[model samples]
Target: MTVIAQLSDIHVRPHGVLYQDAVDSNAMFSAAVDSLNSNRPEPDLVVISGDLTDEGTVDEYQKLRELLARLRQPFVVMPGNHDNRGNLRAAFPDHPWLPGEGSLSFARDVGQLRLVALDTSVPGLHHGELDAASLAWLDDELTVHRDQTVVIFMHHPPFMTGIPYLDIYGLRNADALAMVLARHKNVDRILAGHVHRSMQTRLGNVPVLTCPSTTTQIALRVEADAQPASFLEPPAYMLHRWTGRGQPAVSHLCYVGRFEGPLPFA
Candidate 1:
């Protein structure tokens, strides 16, 4: 079995700074890291989907790099709408998978599972979209990896989440992405992180899910006129356990922070 730990929307702040002059995102991320280190069924890979920084700044990335050095597991990162591709690439010069130019997308194998990371971030915009080249790349990858269970991870989900404010900045060319995905059936699931809350949906006939942020969670409001807001929800992440080909992968939500004892059942 292979276990992949997914942490999303870190929004790391600049050194000695608090995110938005309010939440201490850096501390929250550190706590999350500690939680992962002590977690059972130690993960083989850690995937940080996006929103790596509150602002796409050099200082932020530098601070983020410093924080990530404490993580014990091997990990991969992709950009989100809040990230600057060039800065991100420069900060992680060791991650050769990130392309020298254009979107940061790559397909790599972890154990028996094929992990395909798509770059859905749009420059200078909060809404996400995939260009023609990226779509072509995805289609080609899916075609070549048909025999393996492929799990697509990106910063933005390809479906409307029904949250009024969030949907306003949702993926713009979702139809185009869906079209490309419809051509391939090897995709076991699509994972994302922009929503800052756990959500589930479907695209291209495959299951899609969003991971909760390690900092805050977006309020779950489906009303059409709901306002955009965030809350101090408990920091959390997902542990995706893949047993093998014949069996479906299971995802468990794990919360960060100390809690009361796990007493025996009465």
Candidate 2:
């Protein structure tokens, strides 16, 4: 089995800075890094879905670089609405898996699993949309890696989360994404972030799982016209265990914290 760990919306800031001038997101993110490092069975790869920096500034990326140095597993990152693609690329010059220009998207193979990352972030926009170039890249990658089990990861989810306020910021061209996804049957799952909450839904038969942030979470207020809000809910991440080809990948939502556990099951 191939194990993939995912952390999203870290929202790291420069030293001595807090997210929204309140929550100490950097500290919280550090805790999450610790949690992943000590995770049992040890994940084979780590994918940070997006929102790596709160302001996408050089200092914030530098801080992120310092924080990521503590992680023991290999990692890759994508961009969200809050991220600056150019800055992110500059932050990690050694990550050749990432392209040097245009839409930070790429595909990699982890054992037999084909991991595809899609760039859905639009510059200077809060909502996301998959452009023709990105969609075409995904289609071609999926076409080339037809025999392997595939999982597509992106910043925005293709399905609505039922929260009106957050839904407004959801992927703008989900129908177009569905069209590309519908053609590929080898795609076992689709992973995404940007909602800052854990959600599950399907887009054209393929299951999509959104990872919770490493810091705060979005309040689950589904009432009509509910305003946008955040909560100090427990930070969390996801672990996807891909068993093999033609089988469903099992996912686990792991909360970051120290708690009583490993007790007798009597």
lDDT of 1 by residue, 1-266 (tens): 98999999999999888877889999999999999999776899999999999899999999999999999998999999999999999999999888999899988999899999999999999999999999999989988888888999999988888898998888899899889888887788899999999988888688898999999899989988888889999999999998995576899999999998788875
Clashing pairs for predicted structure model 1, backbone only: none
What are the lDDT scores of the predictions, listed in order? 0.92, 0.92
* Total backbone collisions, model 2: 0
lDDT of 2: 0.92
Task: State the RMSD for candidate 2.
Answer: 1.0
Clash count, candidate 1: 0
Cα shift from native, residue 213, model 1 (Å) = 0.4
| Tens-digit lDDT track of model 2 for 1-266 | 89999999999999998899889999999999999999898999999999999988999999999999999999998999999989999999989999999889999999779999999899889899999998998999989988888999999999888999999898999999899988988889899999999888898899999999988899999999799899999999999998775778899999999889779896
> Which runs of model 2 end up more than 4 angstroms from their true locations?
none
TM-score for each model? 0.97, 0.98
